[model samples]
Target: MMNFSLPMIFSFFMVLCGLWSFVKYHKHLLNSLLSLEFMMLGVFWLMGLQLTSVGMEIYFSLFFLTLAACEGALGLSLLIYVVRSHGNDYFSSFNLLSC
Candidate 1:
C-alpha cells in the first residue's frame, strides 16, 4: 500500500476548497475572480508537490502563476470599468454598443 504524505493531503484539500469556492459563488464577478485565485493557489500547491516528487524545478509553473495574476488583474480592471460606467457589476449590464 502506498502511503500519502502531508503535502499530498494538503494539496488535495486546497483543490477541494478551490473547487468549492468556484461552485459556491458563480454569479458574482468579484467572487468568480476570488475563486479563480483560490484555484490558482491549488495549482501552485500541486506544482510544489510535483517538484518534490519528481526532483525537478517548476519554472513553467511559476510562469503560469504569473500569467494567472495578469489575467486576474485584467479581469478586475474590466470589472472596475464596467462598474464605473454602469454603477453595478452585474453580468447582464454589459452592452458594447451602448458605450
Candidate 2:
C-alpha cells in the first residue's frame, strides 16, 4: 500500500487551488492563463511524485513540462495579439463573432 505523504497532499491541494482560481477569475485573459499554468505545474509535481514512488521513469514528466511550455507560449502569443488589436484582454470586450 502506498502512503500519502505531506508533499503529495500539498500538491493535490495546489491543483485544487489552481482549478478554483481558474473558475473564479476567468474574466481576464491574463488571469486565465496564469491559472492554467498553475494547474499545469501542480499536475507536474503530482506526476513526478507518483512516478518516483512507483519506480517508473521520469521521461513522461519531462515531456509534459515541454508541452506545458509550448502551451504557455501559445497562450501568451494569443494574449498579445488580442491586446494589440483590441487594446485589452477582457473576453467581454473582444467580440469573437465579428469578422
Backbone clashes for every candidate come to 0, 0
* Residue 83 lDDT in candidate 1: 81
Off by over 4 Å in 1: 1-3, 92-99
Model 2 lDDT per residue over 1-99, tens place: 978999999999999999999999989999999999999999999999999989999999999999999999999999999999999988889777873
Clashing pairs for model 1 are none
Q: Tell me which residue pairs clash in candidate 2.
A: none
Residue-level error in angstroms, candidate 2, position 12: 0.8
TM-score of predicted structure 1 = 0.79
lDDT of 2 at 87: 93
What lDDT tens digits, residue by residue, belong to model 1 across residues 1-99? 756888878877887887898788776678877878887888787787777688887887888889988988898998898788988876667777898
- For all predictions, the C-alpha RMSD in Å is 2.3, 1.0
Q: Worst ten-residue run, lDDT, model 2?
A: 90-99
